[model samples]
Target: MCRWLAYMGEPLRASTIVLDAKHSIVAQSLDSPLGAETVNGDGFGFGWYPSDATPTTEPAVFHSIEPAWNNQNLREITRAVESPLFFTHVRAASGPPIQQTNCHPFRYENWMFMHNGAIASWPELRRDLTVAIDPSLYPQVLGTTDSEVLFHLALTLGLRDDPIKAIGQAIRTVETVGHAHNVQFPWQGTVAVSDGATMWAFRYSTSGRTRSLFHSTDVPTLREMYPTVERLATFSDNAKVVVSEPLNDLPGVFVEVPESTAVTLDGDGYRHQPFLAA
Candidate 1:
């Protein structure tokens, strides 16, 4: 398993959430309270839309095989760079080698994706699924982890045009292949994907009991509840975050994403809908 966080709002220094929260992503990497493993030291990665004039194109990425907590460059970069949309992931290496390429927050064009779960019995079904990927896109598979393969499969199935439907189809495809090989619980985890603006988070599993996932409540409402908490005023009204676990112990600050649901966040607000197999 792994731990990850995604942010979408006004541009702010990455450290404000990635390193400054009470239990920030960096802290969670070393001492995660909700993950299956406390120490996700296998590797870590960060992807963010640059602050340049043309920021909506492709995001800049920084990945390392080193533990996130111990990476000095990550510390320096977080304090230096800022973005309205960003992704950070700490890996625990479910079934892949610990290398830069295997580190997450994978990129394709303008979209960035990270997952905090595993595909059950991946080795058994890898051959069947890999063979199904479109030939032109097949060459992009650069890592051995099931996570990257899953991303490419979603792209092949139409992630760019209709992400929600494409992901549903991809999961259905995985379930169908896994069952034929007698593997129960074909999928498990929390997944987040974002273009430069809108973001989507999904919680699902073949067995129906997925890992923990949460999203922050509206910032304005939180300010009304805790008017004296100065930290609450730092974020803009549109600020929103989705993570594998609550970043702080502040009650009402985070809401658990329901089982088998997809959460979408954009300029309007948050929306939740049932995530069914396609």
Candidate 2:
């Protein structure tokens, strides 16, 4: 229902991905060709590790009820700040109240999570899903959106220790609850999560048709392919981006994540694994 992008690799200004690209995240906020909603203007949020010295382990978050395209603060911060990992999301509220808290890229400690999907029949499934969350995490459920609930559900299932399995279990729970309520096609869209270092992205749905997800190919290869494109030099070899859609139309620049798969991107590169009900 929305559009989002996650970056992991060498530290670079957030604008490089969020605002500077040919089809940047800011641009997508107004014109998302891949999202279920064409214009994701409900609100926007960003979460990133601070570059300055600090003892804090939590990532900094900025959320606003204003449309991202019109937010001058976002433009200023994106150009000034840099991070090894960051998440930017433009919201298209499915049914949640439009508030800063409802904006995405939700955080817990060093972890940042965002989703571009919805839980079908959410009103009917909300009570069951909330009850399913571990009581320890129940208090952290500050928002009413199914997306935020799903995040806490993943945490309840042990996202901090094993993100892959945690997310798998969370989805399985959603499917179970949806089935019990007779809600067909209970899941949709791509999700991205990060712990300020490693990133995990998933593309899956109950009906087998998930939303768009793409990852950039190696920067070095892209440079060789388009030698005259000087912007490629701005990124380090380790740089990688997982986005709802390609930021640019560069051929071979983005590879679509297959349906029912989890993609892990780290310093070693990207790896894909099967994602099924667990």
Candidate 3:
């Protein structure tokens, strides 16, 4: 259960959506038509925040247990990198062991995160979410993915003092430790996070069936509906994109993202709400 994308505003080029979009993100790591595993190839990764970053600069990452379409250094380092904000992931090792420190955006200092779904059983809730993290972030949790222990349980329940109320108390502490181990539908998912200048995305599930998320439909409403593509005249009417799907099957070019909501983008644009986390 993995697939990801998050890009925010202008400064582009990570091969314009992880290798030229059209089901891209290395073609959903070799074919993931709306994933839940149709060959996510076990591993891949990316993280960016550079376009002259300085909010405590720590974005450049690139994990790889390889096979994001048989890597050639993930296509020459994502076309030699450029960014306004970014994250790209394609992993399908749901029980965590594809190596490269369990890939995905997962960082901490200036924040970045990624996930597609699953906390459901996670080996019976990974020792109650790794002893509820935050003993100074449990020695920096070097990977045993329930998506990097739900991003250090949303940075020990306060993601820098309120990432949407600390991911709604880190997904209500993963459904209160998966219902005291009885495990009834303990979370499933879609999440994205960023802090080198605001970006957040989420979709939820305790069993309302969530997965698939999308965003992008506001370059003045797709330039008032297409008006001669030309890559929508090279974007930048405050360009934005969020995805677990839809890097173009263009019909209003991506919108979904509405099950328990929470999409936000900054520099004054895009804001969604009602994501009560678990």
Candidate 4:
């Protein structure tokens, strides 16, 4: 129901993927080819870690209710800043009101999270999920979106210690609660989270029909494949991006994440593992 991108490489400006690419996030906000919603103009947001940030420093965030393509300030600010790790999102509100507080890439301390999907029958499951959130983290929830709620739920479940395990537990909890409410297929969509260091992206749904998600092909391979593409040469081989959809149409440039899989990206590289395994 929305679109997002997570970049965990090279200290490049956010505009590189948010604006400059062929089918950029901004363009997808206007006319997405792979999204369930064609125009994700409800709002947009981005969170990035400074190149020299310390463990105590929180990542900077910019969220606005303006459409990505029409937000002049978003362009000005993102173009002026550069970070090695960043998360950008263009929202298509499923049920929540359109407001800045409801924007994606929600933050807590050094962590940032964004999502592009919905909690099926959220109205019925909201109370159970909300009550499950650790009381310490409950006071931090500032929006009504299911995405933000899910983020805090993961944190409360131990996101800071083990993101993959915490998230798996969170999803299982959602499924359990949903089943209790007679709601089938409780969760759906792609989610991304970062702690200003490692980045993680998950693609899953209760029915195994999650939204599209992909990671860029290795830069070195792309360079060898398209020697004349000047842009490919600029990226470091370790550069990685996990996006809701391909930023460009180049064949073999992106690989679709398998259903119920979780991708992890760090200084070394990117790798994926089964997300729903018990």
TM-score for every candidate vs. truth?
0.97, 0.97, 0.34, 0.98
List pairs with backbone clashes in candidate 2: none
On residues 153-260, what C-alpha lDDT tens digit does candidate 1 reach at each position?
A: 899999988888888888889989999999987988888887776789999998888889999999999999889999987899999999999999999999999999
C-alpha lDDT of all candidate models, in order: 0.90, 0.91, 0.85, 0.90
User: Which residues of candidate 1, in runs, are more than 4 Å off?
Assistant: 52-56
Positional deviation of residue 28's Cα in model 2 after best superposition, in angstroms:
0.6
Instruction: Give the top-scoring candidate (lDDT).
Output: 2
Encode model 2's per-residue lDDT on 55-92: one tens digit a residue. Answer: 34689999999999999999999999988888999999
- How far residue 203's Cα lies from its native spot in candidate 3, in Å, is 5.5
Per-residue error for 241 in candidate 3, Å, reads 2.0
Model 4 CA deviation exceeding 4 Å by range: none
Per-residue lDDT over 1-278 for candidate 4, one digit per residue giving the tens place of the 0 to 100 score: 99999887879888877889999999999999999999999999988999898776799999999999999998897898888988899999999999999998999999999998998889888888998999999999999988888999999999999999998889889999999998888989899998888899999999888999999988989998899998886677888888888998889999999998999888777888999953
Cα deviation at 135, candidate 1, in Å, is 1.2
Best by TM-score: 4
Instruction: Give residue 263's error in model 1 in angstroms.
Output: 0.8
Q: Tell me the number of clashing residue pairs for each predicted model.
A: 0, 0, 0, 0
Report residue 256 deviation for candidate 4 (angstroms): 0.6
What is the Å distance of residue 12 in model 4 from its true position?
Answer: 0.6
